[model samples]
Target: MINQSELENSKEVGIITDISDKELHLALGLSDPTCNNEISQQDQNESTHDTSNSTAPSEPQLFFQAVGLVRGQYLPSTEKLGSGILLLDDGVIAPTNLLASAVYTVKKHPNLLESPQVWIVYPRVQVKNPPFLNFAIRGARLPLEGEDAEVINQSVDDFSIRGIVTYTNRKAGNFVIKVYRNFMPWKEQEGTKYKPHIFTITGVLPSEGLPCGQFWDLKVKRVADQLVLEDATFITQVFEPKKPKKGRSKRQGQKRKAKRNQSNPQ
Candidate 1:
């Protein structure tokens, strides 16, 4: 047998004894082994918090963008009652029901040969009963049975029909007037082109388009034996709220990934 000191030296040299975790904890005066678990739990909670507060992507908005004169026209069933045809800017005649409203600004006033004429046609709207065209003009206050003969010519020839209220018979489809100047008031803002005769006729639909079979017969309401202008419609092509776009953005994709990772922690 070896000597005691030799045995002790041999054990110390041959096998290095390390302190156990239990011994280390006891030395450090720690009773709870769950501290590490608590730290891990805190880290997880922080990750979840970051993910919860993250913002997703936003959607785009909808608005109306106007398309030009190629989209204009008179309403349906109002033909054969005019001295001259109301042609488009391209010299093409506007079809019936081209517009969803009756309000037209006279860009080019009519000559004696090419009179300003249109047929009053109404648009179809959603209602229990069909709607009627109630015709009336404004600002005209036509001379009171020969108050002054010159008053008629001046009123008719003026480049501005703003607030001029006149009347037409609701008996026929031919609504006629004559403009003598090619007034483009819209151009007035760009430069002094020509003074425009803007006619603000009422009884037009505020929006566009009409469904099938939604029109009523003409309603005759005369303002001092003058024909009323009603139910005429003009349509325009505009970009409104269309379908939403198809893909997600980079940040949005990252947000989705974060959510997935949160749901299933590694």
Candidate 2:
């Protein structure tokens, strides 16, 4: 039951699964995401039948049924601090810390909302202090400094939910959204993925209800002076909410500051 205008043009996260021994481990919320991958790696990352057709064209991006509408959604009003955590599956927490590693390279961004912000390195495994509930990405160009996104489960709706403001720090909290290019995701076969966006927030948790977003536009590389991100930290942003410029109408700056305070009255 999601379509509040496509979860407000989406960034809506929903998908839940947590087997254990057999290693299903892929939660989002409400459960429903289990692919054996036909014995694993979807059969060693399948797809290899070009029949001398010279298959090496590559280069063709654009897709998004729901990578959160190329990752763009906001609600703000939880408390803050990038408050998003949920990750409960451990055989030592491998599969790139939580990516569950099966072989992924999604590239959806042809126009409609643009999904695929870049900056991928799945695998953190520190599970002793900070779990994971800080899923972020908005026009992410890559190079995510400090890195985040852990929680596998604790019932934060299931996992990866959004609608923040829990105090401040969804990477400085507040809001940011962009990248609404529109539609993209092409893969006839290779795990059979065309577009599988799962989202359903009934009571907010896997990040507080709804906000599976991503769409950034940042450029920082200061290094010593600080500020950096070009390859690791879930880099992505596109939260546009800056429109406050309509002054001079308050009786023209109070009648030119009362005619310069009557020509200077100290």
Candidate 3:
């Protein structure tokens, strides 16, 4: 739901280092190449850039879109003054300077966390040696209501998410969903026996709307990173306890009363 207008102002654009058919097929769950003929045709037409002469081959650059839950703004310790921390989608706790701007933006606008459906735009450049993906948030914003979904979908190069909705501001037109690393098992003291050890890729939708407690399954896709509402479903609902109001605890009140009685000696 990122507004089209905002994308123009975005500073960082994503890059696709590798778009091989096999990779695309695995990522998008496409059974036939004909389904994504546009991407395949484009790939076939473009000649591979030779990197031996240059520092690195210039790859296709596009905006990468992802829905992330803003766990919270990280405040670095005194020793690491400028460094910042960001808990991104899939429980990946990133404590680095790369997300410094994103962290500052979130801190400046605390409201972003309220509707934690944060739209992250970054370059998806793959590092050669370590085989790690290095991403930097170029821009981010809360999705607007009645925004053009088609425009947002077309701009991004890739999109993948699996998480639970932490917050929802339907009036503002967005909801927060969190993602977890794959193969991470679900841990619970009581429900361990019933649920599977690892999370399921697909889930069932019991009701309508992206409720706060619902666990979403957003994996299946014909085109890489193009999300379809019909394909998105919910696995189950999670009921979280309401946070207690800030104040003195019952134990503290009792201790205060005891201190008063001791001083008064009535």
Candidate 4:
């Protein structure tokens, strides 16, 4: 299961963009086509049984055939990320076996003109894992001058970046590229552009040395005009909840090895 503890530990935040009520209904298992028929049958059968056999409605139970969707910007709080108002089929505490975060599943529409949508947000506990991380660069200019094409945040795993980027004068193949743990590098990857003061980095967790609860600083050599310079600082943190690891079976491992061999083509 997705680890909520780590998410809670990390001091990161996000805002809810959009929400889809229809998708949420499906997620909550409230949109069953046979729901009405099943309820009718159950009621009829209960009527035939002894009146005493019927479950007493001592406590009132609320039933919702439909739920409303509210979309807005949920600003970040000290403890957790922001969230949208969504009425779920049932009131369920997140961090249960089923849910990875407070919000069930988020559909991202990055470039959409409309406000992004988020399904639900509980009043008490904010989501530990947000859909993405907001990364902003400070005190830096675009298109790093000289041999320093860009400062790439290399990640060995999907959750957080943990790798090395060296500045060398080899004269060939010295360009640094940014990439996620298991994802391919962006085709148009370039150095940090100063246009957008804030940027987003999507990852699940931090590197081994980095603390889970706090942000860590990375001091890199600032480059300008083909000259080595003093240390430039960059910060990194886990944006969202890291996906749970899946154990690989023997057959799957064998298949991976075979695929690797085919690609190498000895």
The parts of candidate 4 lying over 4 Å away from their true place are 1-209, 212-214, 222-244, 247-266
Q: Is candidate 2 or candidate 3 better by TM-score?
A: 3
Report the Cα lDDT for residue 132, model 2: 19
Q: Kindly list the per-residue Cα lDDT of model 3 for residues 1-266, writing each as its tens digit.
A: 33333223212111112133333323333233223223354543452343231112122111112332232233444675345444444444444343677667766865654542344533222223321222345336444698875555443333354545544433333344443222112232432322211111223333444355455555332122122333455555443413223456588899999999999996
Ranking by TM-score: 3, 2, 1, 4
Q: In model 4, where is the ten-residue run with the lowest total lDDT? A: 59-68
TM-score of each prediction: 0.15, 0.18, 0.25, 0.15
Tens digits of per-residue lDDT, candidate 2, 32-93, equal: 22322233445334434532211222211211111211112212225532222222121111
**TM match of model 2 to true structure:** 0.18
Ten residues in a row with the worst lDDT in model 1? 59-68
Check candidate 3 and list the clashing pairs: 14-123, 90-179, 90-180, 163-178
Q: Which segments of model 2 are wrong by more than 4 Å? A: 1-173, 179-181, 184-251, 254-266
| Best TM-score among the predictions, by candidate number | 3
Residue-level lDDT of model 4, residues 30-107, one tens digit each, is 332212323355665765574442222211121111111222322223453322222212322122111243222222
lDDT for model 3: 0.38
Query: Which whole-number lDDT from 0 to 100 does residue 245 have in model 3?
Result: 31
Q: Candidate 2's error at 240, in angstroms?
A: 12
Error of 4 at 166 (Å): 19
List candidate 1 segments past 4 Å from native: 1-191, 204-228, 238-266
Q: For model 1, state the Cα shift of residue 152 in Å.
A: 20
What's the CA RMSD for each of the models?
Answer: 36.9, 21.4, 20.8, 23.4
